[model samples]
Target: MVRTIILALGLMLSVAAQAQEAKRADVEALLEASNMDAMIESIYAQTNKMFAGMGQQLGIKPDEQQLFDDYMNEVTSAMRKEVSWAKMKEPMVQIYLKHYSDKEIKDMLAFYQSETGQSMVKKMPAVTQDSMMLSQQMLQNFLPKIQVIAEDFNQKLQAHRQAK
Candidate 1:
């Protein structure tokens, strides 16, 4: 009975591993459709912001849109097929399998394939763009305050050294 049980478990595990391996690429492709492009675009947008600020600060005007587009084009040129199998799937699958059953992954995939899920995928780039802009704006807003604090600390250190 013990041997039989072990054999049965082994077979089940093998089947599951195969299923995960097969569906992984499909999921990766779906994730890639939005994820990869969004990541590249984000890089472009940040670069655009940096150059725009530099142009303003240095009195050298950079064509913001053109600079952004040019950087995006360069990123696209380097884009290739999936980098690796692991890139397609989060490493948490091993834990997911341990915690959640096969049914959960399938259900999640099914939901993701649904209209709402499709819409989320479609809007993700815009969502990422807006979020990135907000985050960068926040960082830029904080910069002056950070600089002030750093300068205050530096002045105090300089005074202390002079007194010593």
Candidate 2:
């Protein structure tokens, strides 16, 4: 009876291990279908554009352009090394496992493998890029109001401190 119990426990452990492996595989497949590498590249591209705009606003001299470009290149290289899909894949998988059930992961995998899903994945980078630009423009438009509010708050704080 003891031997039978031990065998049954081992079988259950094996099944659980197999299920975990299957779930991990599905999660990986879903991430692949999502084109995460492209997403990362898109973020890097956007960062470059933002920094270039800042440099222009800062009035970087023509002769300094080379130095700025070189610096940007180094930043991009570091980002690629540190945040590459290969380095992030395991942690991302674990995060998915923590948040999603096995069935949900499988369902997402199926969707990402479909035609509509593929189309969305292909266009997602551009969509994100445009969204970021819109956000930046909005912020630029609103900055003067924020600055005025901040100045008013600072003056009030100074007055309160002096009163104390």
Candidate 3:
């Protein structure tokens, strides 16, 4: 009876191991269909564009612009080194596995391999960039309102403190 129990336990463990391997394989297939490298490269490209504007935003003088550019180059290089598919894949896969079932993962893989999915992947960077620009513009428009609210809050706080 003990031997039978041991054999049953061993079989269950083997099945569990195989299920994990299958899950990982599904995750990898999903990643491949999503063209993860292109996604990472798009992010880096957007970062470069953002960094290009930082000097102007900070009002850096012409004389110091070269220095700013050099610093930005170093920053970009560091980001490129850190943000590769290889570095991100394991953590991303773990997150997916935690949240998604094997069937769900397979569905995702199928969707990403579709033509519409390919188009979305191709356009995602531009969509993100435009959305970011719109968000920044909205924030700029709201800045004065935010400042007024803060000032009003401060005055009320000061009045309360004096009363206390």
TM-scores of the models, in the order given: 0.56, 0.94, 0.90
lDDT of 3 by residue, 135-158 (tens): 979998999999999999999999
lDDT of 1 by residue, 87-119 (tens): 434753444555655566667667667888778
Candidate 3 or 1, higher lDDT = 3
Backbone collisions counted per model:
0, 0, 0
**Candidate 2 versus the native: TM-score?**
0.94
Q: Could you give me the TM-score of model 3 versus the true structure? A: 0.90
- For candidate 3, give the lDDT of residue 116: 92
Can you write out model 2's per-residue Cα lDDT over 64-158, one digit (the tens) per residue? 99998898788879988998888988999999999999889888888989999999999998899889989999999999999999999999999
Worst 10 residues of 3 by lDDT: 117-126
Local distance difference test values of all predictions, in order: 0.65, 0.90, 0.91
Candidate 2: which pairs clash?
none
Give the lDDT of residue 145 in candidate 1. 100
